[model samples]
Target: MTYKGNSIFKGKFFVWLALIILAVVPLFSGLYWQGILVLVCYYAYAAIAWNFICGYAGTMSLGHSVYMGIGGYISTIILETKGVSPWIGMIVGAAVAMCLGVIISYPTFRLKGPYFTLSSIAIVELLGTFISNTESLGPVPIKGGSGWSLSQTGNQAVMFEFSSKLSYFYIAFALMVIGLFVTYRMSESKLGYYLVAIRSDDDAAKSLGINVTKYKLIAMAISCFMISIAGTFYAQYFRYIGPDRIFSYDLSVQVALIALIGGQGTVMGPIIGAIILVPLSEMLSAKFAGQMSGLNLFLYGVVMMLVVYFMPHGFGEHVVSILQKAEEKIFGRIKRKAKD
Candidate 1:
C-alpha cells in the first residue's frame, strides 16, 4: 500500500484498539481508579473543545468555563424541576451554550489576541458576579450573612446521581468518544482548512474570500456545544453543581493547559495532553493535597512551564515524529537485508 493508505489504516486500527481497551477497563480497575479515569475522560473532552478555538482558530479564551458552568446548571435545573431526563437535558444545555458562544463571539472576534482573551476573562467575571448576587437564581439563599440550599433535592438517578463510580466512568468514556469523533471530523473538513487559514493569517484568509467571522463563529459554536455536553455529563456524574466549582477561571486554564501540553491543533494532541496531565495531577492531589494544600497545583504549574519551554509542540507531535523515524530506519534495514 501507499504511505497515505498505510497511515489511514494505522489510524483506524489504533482507534479500534483504543475503543476495545476502554470497553474492558472498567471490568478490571477498582472503584477509585475508575473514578479517576472518569475525571480523565471529562478533562479530555474539555481539552478537545478548547483546542478547537485556541489551537485551531488561534483564539485564546480565558473564560471557556462559562459555557461548561452554564451547561451544567441548565441541565441540572431542567432535569430536577421539569422532570426531564438528563439525556434530553444534554441537548438543551448544549443549545444554550451554542447561543451564548454566538453572542460572545460577535463582539469579541473583532479583537486581536490578548485583547480577545481579556474580554473573555471580563465576561466570565461579570457573569460570575451576576450569578452569585442574583437572589432568585443564586446557588444559596442568603439570610443576612448566612446562606441556604440552592439545589433541588430528589432521587439521585433522576437528577443524574449514581451510587456506583462505574456508571460515571462509562458516561464519561462515551462523552470522550463523541468529543474525539467530532474533533476528528472537523479537522478533516473544509471548515477545518478555513480555520487553519484564519489562524495563520486572518487578513490573508479574508483576502482569499474566506468568511472569517462566519467560520470563527461556527468554530466557537461547535466548541461550546461539545464542551456543554461535557458539562451535562459532569452534573450527572457529580450530582451537584455550584458556580465556584464550575465557572471558575481555573477550569478554563486547565483546559488550555491540557491542549497546549498535548500538541494543540493536531487531532490527537488534546487527548494526549489530557491523558498525561490529568492523571499526574490527580495522583499528586490525592497523595499530597490534604497535607500540603496548594503544593500539587504549584508542581503542576512548574511542570507546565517546563513543557512549554522544551516541548512547545506537545508530546503527541513528538511521539508521532519518533514513530515515523523508527519506521524509516526499520524499512531501510529491511531493504539492505533484501539486497544481502
Candidate 2:
C-alpha cells in the first residue's frame, strides 16, 4: 500500500518534470524546432479546451474551429483597422466566441450521439462557407478567401508583436501551462463532477434533478472561450489568419483526434497526444515531402486504430501504470544495494 502511494507520487512528479524540461527546449532549439514546439503548444491548448465538453460532457463536437476562426479573424481585423492591441482583442474575441457557443449549443443539446457530432460538422461547414464568400461585414473587410496578415508593430510586448521566436515560445508555453492548471482544477470541482455525471448518463442525471442542458451549455461556453484564446495566440504567432485554414474541418478533426487519442476524459490526455503526434507529424512531412504527402495521415490513422483497440480509455491511463512499474524496479534495486 505504501509502495502504491509512492508510485502515484512518483508518476505525477516525473510527469511535471517532463513539463519543466519542455519549458527550456526553446533556448537550445533553432527557429524551426521552436516553431514546431509552438505548434505543439497550440494543439495542446486547443485540445484541452475541446476535451472539456467532448471528453468530459461527452458532447463530441467537431465545430470548434469556428470559434478559433472567429477569434483569429476578430483579433487580426481589430489590430489592422483600429490599431487595437491583440491583448485587448483577445478578450473581445473570447467574449464573442462564448456567446456564439452558447447560442449554437442550446439547440444542439437536443441532439444525441452521432446526430450531435454531425450537426457540429455542419456548423463548421456553414460558417466556413459563409466567411469564404463574405468580403466585408459592413465596413470591415472580412477578406473573404484571401485572409488577414498582421503587420508587426516592432517587438512591442504591449502590442503582442514579437521579433524573436523565443517570444512566441514564451507566450505559447505560458498558455499551455495555464491550460494544464485549469484542467487540473476542473477535475476537482463540482462542475467537473456534474460534467462527468452528464457524460456517464445524462438521462439519469436529469432525472436526479440536474439541469443537463444548462450544465452542457456552460461547458460549451467555457470551451469556446478557452479555445478562442488559443486562436488569438494562433493568429499572433503565425501573423496570419484564414478561414480556409483556421476554419478547416481538418483542423477541428486534428484537435479532436489529439484529445481522443491521448485519452478523452483524462486531463493529461491532450498534452500527451500533442507531444507524441505533433513531432511525428513534423518529421513525417519533412521526410516524405512531395512523394509521400499522405504518409503522416496514414500513420495517424494507424496510431488511432491502435490506441482505440489497446487503450480505449486513452494513453493517459497507461502513464501511471508505466511509472508504477519503473518505481518498483528502481526502488527494489536500491533496497538490494543497501542490504548487500
* Ten-residue stretch with the least lDDT total in model 2: 1-10
Residue 271 shift from truth in candidate 1, angstroms: 1.0
State candidate 1's TM-score: 0.87
Candidate 1 residue-wise lDDT, 1-340, digit = tens: 2122113234554556656787678779998788778888899889888888778888989889999977876777776567788788888999999999999889999999999999999988887666666555455332221212235454476556567888777778877888777877887789988998999999999999999999999999999998988888877776666677677787888888888787778777777777778778788889885797776567657867988898876777666566557666877689788999
Question: Candidate 2 residues 220-286, lDDT tens each?
Answer: 8988999999999999988889888899888898899999888887778898889989989988898
What's the lDDT for residue 313 in model 1? 69
Per-residue lDDT value at 25 in model 2: 84
lDDT (0 to 1) per candidate: 0.77, 0.86
Candidate 1 has its poorest 10 consecutive residues by lDDT at 141-150
